[model samples]
Target: MSSSSTFPRARKPKLGYDTDQVEEFLRVARRAFDGTPAPGDPEVSAEKIRLTAFGMQKGGYSTAHVDAALERLEDAFAARERQIAARLHGDEAWLREARTTAQVVSNRLARADGERFERVNPLVLGYSVKEVDRFAERLSRYFSDGWPIGIDDVRTVTFRAQRGGYRESQVDLVLDAVVDVMLAVR
Candidate 1:
């Protein structure tokens, strides 16, 4: 268990997360992150943080503050994981993996706009073809010319929805892979 001093206390409000529950969860998450052995504690992962749910209550942590903190925590965990993988696999293998993944993204991007990803159902909207294609072009340049880009850049990307656009799931999966590969190499 982490020292109480390290945990940020929640404020009381009409509606907010349950402070005690949130604090306990954070303690477990912190222990996992620090690589401390804790019986029955699940290994912490970025996805876990991303999807974490907190109970609501009258007096609790500020949602915005908690969310921002969680984002930073997730990034730190991802960076640490990347560093460990690179250390274990060696630079050559890491770079090779990155290049191969980049190639996959490039090939997918090279396809015709509407055909790049599977379309959503006729009634439902999908990602905008023009918007995704434009971003894909930038991503291609980043791969070819070593252009500077950040994981946040890819993670925060948004596309307008259109009736017959590319599949959002496919684009998002590729972007997530790109972020992982980039982080591993860096």
Candidate 2:
């Protein structure tokens, strides 16, 4: 009976928001930024607000606004991905664990065929659990500034970065170490 395609448009023009504003934008749907939820729980309310806000009003958005938001979101996601990836790529402890694990894996492959080492450099042989701990300890010594977020923030950040291939166990361990150090300083 109605000719309208959509109902209840966005009250605020998020599309018109500048870059800095978008970066800090939280969907205006949540009542408050309260404490953390339990483990494995989603930030459902916040996520739903964002999705519904854009999706529900998709038809109303100018292509430029949608494009801009999409671009900003993409960049943020990419940066977070790189931040997590860099953990394994250069983390002394992670590299050591991976190297040690790889060495064992590689040796097995090498044993299967004598020329395996020629095709793949086995790094596990070079790693020791002790070595990784020492490096992790050293890493723990470095400090970052700011009103560091709570344990919940650690959980949130970890969960956010997992889509880029970050393992949950690894994130927990690294964050555990980082949080311990930060807490100790306080």
RMSD of each: 4.0, 16.6
Candidate 2 has what TM-score?
0.22
Candidate 2 local Cα displacement, residue 72, angstroms:
1.6
Which 10-residue span in candidate 1 carries the lowest summed lDDT? 1-10
- TM-score: model 1 vs. ground truth: 0.74
Clashing pairs in 2: 99-124, 100-124, 103-124
Clashing pairs in 1: none
**Model 2 stretches with alpha carbons more than 4 Å out:** 1-59, 91-186
lDDT of each: 0.76, 0.35
Residue-wise C-alpha lDDT for candidate 1, range 47-165, written one tens digit per residue: 67755789887656677667777778878877877677679987688778878988898788778756778888878899998899888878877877877777678867899989878
Clash counts for the predictions, in order? 0, 3
TM-score, per-candidate, Cα-based:
0.74, 0.22
